[model samples]
Target: MKVSKEQSDANRAALVKAASKLFREKGIDGVGVAEISKEAGLTHGALYAHFPSKSALAAEALALGLELANKKLYGKSADEAPDLDAFLDYYLSTRQRDNLGGHCAMAASASEIGRQDEDVSASFTEGYLEMVRAFENHVAQARPELDSSSRGLALVAALIGGVAMARATQKSNPALSKKVLQGMRELVDEAGGLGKK
Candidate 1:
């Protein structure tokens, strides 16, 4: 039977939602198209109808995942207080570390993305730059006397690296893992407060 336009759009959305979560939980190469379709409660044929190729699906998925992350991390407008404390409290929490699919896409898939095609890499790069710009603006508000752009990049690097390290040591040295998160949070928080009178 021919699917209606509405149903087709719904099915496409479902696939992208499922793809975003699964691809973040598992790297782009970790999960396959068959698994994504199954997770979305659709067949492989339906998945293909929506996306031309797995890479295409993955690129979209990564973008969606990062978009969600950005919304979660930074609010809707530049006027919002950068809430670095809130970000640190949640991001470094054990809950965020445990939920791989719900965390930042970069921390989840940056390594694997480097090996993928240019489309996927480009998607990641674009999301990353957007995040940096947001962070820079926020940092500037918090600390006007310093070079906010450079500091913003450092802050992002610290957050991503801290989360990655925490996740990596989560199973082994849990204490060190917690310290990694706490330490990075402290450093970033201190830096943000540095230039304030």
Candidate 2:
């Protein structure tokens, strides 16, 4: 039977959405095409009809998840920051760390993507750079005195590192996790206050 174009699009979207959340919650290697198809409520055969390979599916899903996150954090354009502090609070929060499936895809899956094929890595790198560039532009606006490029890179690293470390220690040592969040927040606050002085 020939599937309608609408149905085909919906199925592809559902697969990407399910794969995005699952890929974040579990590393790329942790979830397979079968599990993603099952979660998306589509058959394994249906999944193949949409994607040629698991890597292809993963690359698209990663891009979708990162795009969603960038939209949430930075709005429609990279330069617009409706609420910078709010972004910092949510990003560095324990809640965000605990909810890996709903937070930063890079922090969750960068290590796994690093091990994947060139295409997958390139897809992730593109989104990752876009996100960092957004931060760079935001920092340039807020702190004209400082080197925005280096600061943006540092801020992105600290944000991802803080969240990753917090999640890692959330179970073994909750205090350390909290400290990671607090430290990053403090550093961000300091950076924000720099050009004002």
Candidate 3:
């Protein structure tokens, strides 16, 4: 049967969505195009029609997930914030950490990114810089008097690192996850008061 254009588009989206979940759950190397196609409810050939290679699928899925996360976590950049403290609080919240696909591309896929080939790594790098830009924008707006560039770098580095540490401790000690988040949150408070690291 000939598939409608709408159906074809849906299939392509399904493949990316399914691959996004799988890539988050398992490292990119741990999955194959055949597996992703199966998960998407399409044949492997159909999968190739949308994405020529597994790396292509991974890159697209990673980009999609990051775009979704920026909207979900930070909302519009126009409604900017200088409130690094509030951003830290929300970024490290329980809800944010618990939602794997919904939370962040980097936090969910950083380990996989390191293991990936250069193409995927390049995608990851680009997405990470976009995140940094957004964070820096907020920091600069929130505190024009402060050194916004360094503060932005510190804030983003600390939050993402906290998320990574929390994820690592999830199975071993769930309590530690909260502690790491809380510690990072307090770091903002500490920095707000002192010009210290």
lDDT of each: 0.84, 0.84, 0.75
Q: Kindly state the number of residue pairs that clash in model 2.
A: 0
Better of 2 and 3 by TM-score: 2
As for TM-score, the candidate ahead, 1 or 3, is: 1
Off by over 4 Å in 2: 76-79, 192-197
TM-score of each: 0.91, 0.91, 0.82
Residue pairs clashing, model 2: none
Model 3 per-residue lDDT tens digits across residues 17-52: 988888776767777888888999999999888887
Q: Work out candidate 1's RMSD over C-alphas.
A: 2.3
lDDT of 2 at 122: 84
TM-score of 3: 0.82
lDDT of 3 at 184: 78
lDDT of 2 by residue, 1-197 (tens): 99999999999999999999999999889998889999999999999999999999999999998888777778766555545667777778788889989999988986687689988898888877876786787778877888988888777777787788889889999998899889888887787542213
